[model samples]
Target: MTRPSLLAAIAIASLSTITTGAFAADQLVVASFGGAYTASQSKAFIEPYMAEKGAKVLTADYNGGLAELRSQVQSGNGAWDVIDLELQDALRACDDGLIEKIDASQLAPAADGTAAADDFLPGTLMDCGVGTIMWSNIIAYDKTKFQNGGPKTIADFFDLEKFPGKRGLSNKPNVNLEWALMADGVPNDKIYETLATEEGLNRAFAKLDTIKKDAVFWGAHAQAPQLLADGEVVMTAAANGRIYDAISKEHKPFEIVWDGQIWNLDVWAISKASKNKDAALDFVKFSTTGPRLADVTKYISYGPVRKSSQGLVPEAIRTNLPTYETNFKTSLANDLEFWADHQDEINQRWATWMAK
Candidate 1:
């Protein structure tokens, strides 16, 4: 099927679940990054919510950014009711009034009676966003390409002489900058502190320049895995869950290297211009419950935000999660506040560097 027609078919199928005939007024539109992540949300959150509320829920996919949400809010015609955003974008959007502020009291408490605020991990809840999952961007490579183990550390990713091939990196400056700094010998704890300065920014760009000619920049999550599979790049930086999905479901030989993995939260925020404010808020409350958050692990490798949800995750999947102790030992939590403060300046710098 043609791409447009296929999307139309998916939309029709989603609307059909409402059991109501051709009613568009009551529908809720949710926006998220596409691929395995959205598929997991569809199973663990959207489908169940639709079944219980008998509400039509349409899904829209986007490469993560604040531009679309910003445009919708400015024009007062938001097409999305709820959106999944990276931590930095969520913070920026909430501060800019592009999304509605959520009352913590309105959220459902854990099954054990703990308050929602106390149950969620520290820094997960924000004024306008409810934390959904904790995920990571890690180095993933085809195991077959490396006979004697693989690039084991963040530094090794930049060592083209040791492991020669094209490298795949996200086109954005967020994680790439962090990885570049780490690979250049900046300690994890001191990453943002160092990056906040002019010299540090130059250091990161200089490190990245080493691989610029051989780098394959990908804009979407799915492209990372496809690049490795097609041998377009020997190794790529990818979301941990995407690599996990490819390995476990498709039996791909990709392996994830946890060293210097940059982890962050994905939050669900309501667009300020949403037509269905109350319904959208209700959906957020429903989907973030302890049980619902835990249920998502059945579909993806992301860790749930609620403490109560941790024990509920199956043992098999728990070890694969970004929160798993062994995997997290060398991980760095992406500093959302730092990015919120410096994103514009850094992005401008990144664009200039790319042009060169």
Candidate 2:
């Protein structure tokens, strides 16, 4: 009850109010593909937004899929405020009313004052989502295996006789099927169209049968790089970012073949059930700007979705990006619509094919 004690308590209360009042009222929960990918996003997007808006930002990880988002939305009490989603998943979630629709005008425009619609790469902007990065699923080989030369084309990856080693492939069928058809002599632009036909499906599966015996399948992103570094498989069909991390961080002897690379965009989506929907959309707008998008490439090799961000990417790593002009010319743009429509049936066929 002393004056000194009462004064000390008053001072502490004032300090608490000053600190807490600096931040926004709502706590934002963001979900993403974890590890380095999320790490990059945290540095580029979350940290700065929290600092500027004084918002409390929390993060969670998920294997890329709509199931978790659906669970949250359908339950009507979703914990996540925002999520990073694959384009196809984003499209489906928007259609299913699992995520909030985005207005492209609400997004920040280019540094040059170009409209957001004009600044973002083709197919990067969508009705319900805005893409942040363009990533590739491509082939990578252990440099130690082929000192003189390695896989120069997608077909080289399939030629077991020439490469003469076990191949590592993702368990998912999307990229694998695309690669199979391209290697089987289908043109890069014609891959998805060909895949839509029964004959094309048969051809892709038949081509896969060639390497099925020696192929070592991986279920996770990290496992692909580890498979190459540990020499379990001489080469892998892997995300370019994983391969880049292996070579740059782990110092693994890996080489990427950009030819016939299947590339797609990863987008940010707001949860329809989120209590902090406006704050979530605010974060999306802040993150998708050119400079913010460019900052991400410092941690990962994925290309920024904004065309302007390309100029900001470091020169040394420019060629490594999926959207790099020279590399993109030979690469395949993954058809998000095709996968969105056919994912279930294709996945079922993939399971049956794998079971045999």
Q: Candidate 2 lDDT, tens digit per residue, 1-356?
A: 01112112211111110011122447999998776778889999999988888888999988888778888888998899899988778878877988877777778889999989779866677767788988889899998999778989999999999898999998989899989998999987688889999999999999999999999998777788888888999999988998887788778889999988877778998888888777777888889999999998888899997888988988887877887778887776677667866889999999999999
Candidate 2 TM-score versus the reference? 0.89
Each prediction's Cα lDDT score? 0.86, 0.82
Q: How far does residue 64 in candidate 1 sit from its true spot (Å)? A: 1.2
Give the per-residue lDDT of model 1 (tens digit) for 160-199.
Answer: 9988889999988998988999999999888888899999
TM-scores for all predictions: 0.91, 0.89
Pick by TM-score: which candidate is best?
A: 1
Off by over 4 Å in 1: 1-25
Residue-level lDDT for 327 in candidate 2: 82
